[model samples]
Target: DDTPYDTQFCNWTVQSRFPSNQVTLGPWVNPTFLVGDFGLLRESFKNQEWGFQNWTTRRLQLTYNGLSWRDTAQVQFSMRRKAYWYTINIVIPSQIMWVMCYSSLYIRPDASPARVSLVVLSILTLITLSNRAFDMLPIVSEPVWITDYLFILNILCCAHLAQFILLHSALRAQDRRKKRKQQQQQQD
Candidate 1:
């Protein structure tokens, strides 16, 4: 029995005696998180109150404590958000941009096929890596994801390269034409 702010999460506890057929309990733990501006303290439980999520954290604690417990009931856990969460956010967005932009740019006729292929493949790899990294997303899988961000970034890079290549080729052709005219004039 848990009450709001008192027993609900403040003094967190769990019945973690999972049976063999069920998922193995990795030991009971208290969850702690650092958001952009706030540090959350939480405790996890397999036995939450009725109408609550089955396997979710109960409360968040703001302080850093060693992951130790006097009894088998709980272990104080800590992880750096900056070290993991924020870093992932940057990588995810970068991957999406790469894939979206490069997919189109790689198809340009004026761009070097070899370079285009390499860029596309490299970005695709990053997208895949990011996808795997975010395999345990809090939200449901959707069209937009960390992988998607990398994909779009690759595409953008390819587009920029293609534009530059196109410009270079056009200028080269123009120079050749000017030289031909000069030769013709000299012969005349």
Candidate 2:
């Protein structure tokens, strides 16, 4: 599936076989003039989760076999997925998870259980959110904007976890050194 902001161009053409001279078909400037149920068409597009944009209409005369000329009317438009829905459901939640994941850095490294649990939980929740986002979208060969965003978040989470691990190891080593120094002082 393409990103919410990604637009798709579409064209609809109506051609009449009547000779241009005998009967003039259309230069339908208004969609309502072209289709009696223009509102219905708009609602149907909305139902399909697309927002219509950049609409234009053109009239042309086409000749076939160099003998007959026909009247043609064309409607051109662009469509995009409704972005507000994605912003509310996927983007906001993912951002919150990212914030929570990074916030683990503030926790004292000595409290390994709390710090590790916070980071791990954030990672798990982010993964769940990413999966939910993908489930809402149709499968496509290429990655979309949401996919890239989630991937970046995943990388950041891993980095934070690695930092915590290193910090915890260093603290433990320092504590061991302090204990050894105390024992040497007592023996002396």
The top-ranked prediction according to lDDT is: 2
lDDT of 1 by residue, 1-188 (tens): 11111112232333323222222234333333321122222233222222222223332233224542222222233321222443455564565545554554445445566555656666566655556555634443355444455565656676666665776688689989999999999999
Report the poorest 10 consecutive residues by lDDT, candidate 1. Answer: 1-10
lDDT of each: 0.45, 0.76
* Per-residue alpha-carbon lDDT of candidate 2 for residues 2-103, written as tens digits (9 for 90 to 100): 575678899887677677443333344556534332221333345456778776766678786798877766668898877888888888988888898888
TM-score of each candidate structure, all chains considered together: 0.37, 0.79
RMSD of 1: 14.7
Model 2: colliding residue pairs: none
Error of 1 at 157 (Å): 1.0
Residue 137 lDDT, candidate 2, scale 0-100: 77
Model 2 stretches with alpha carbons more than 4 Å out? 17-45, 138-143
Best by TM-score: 2
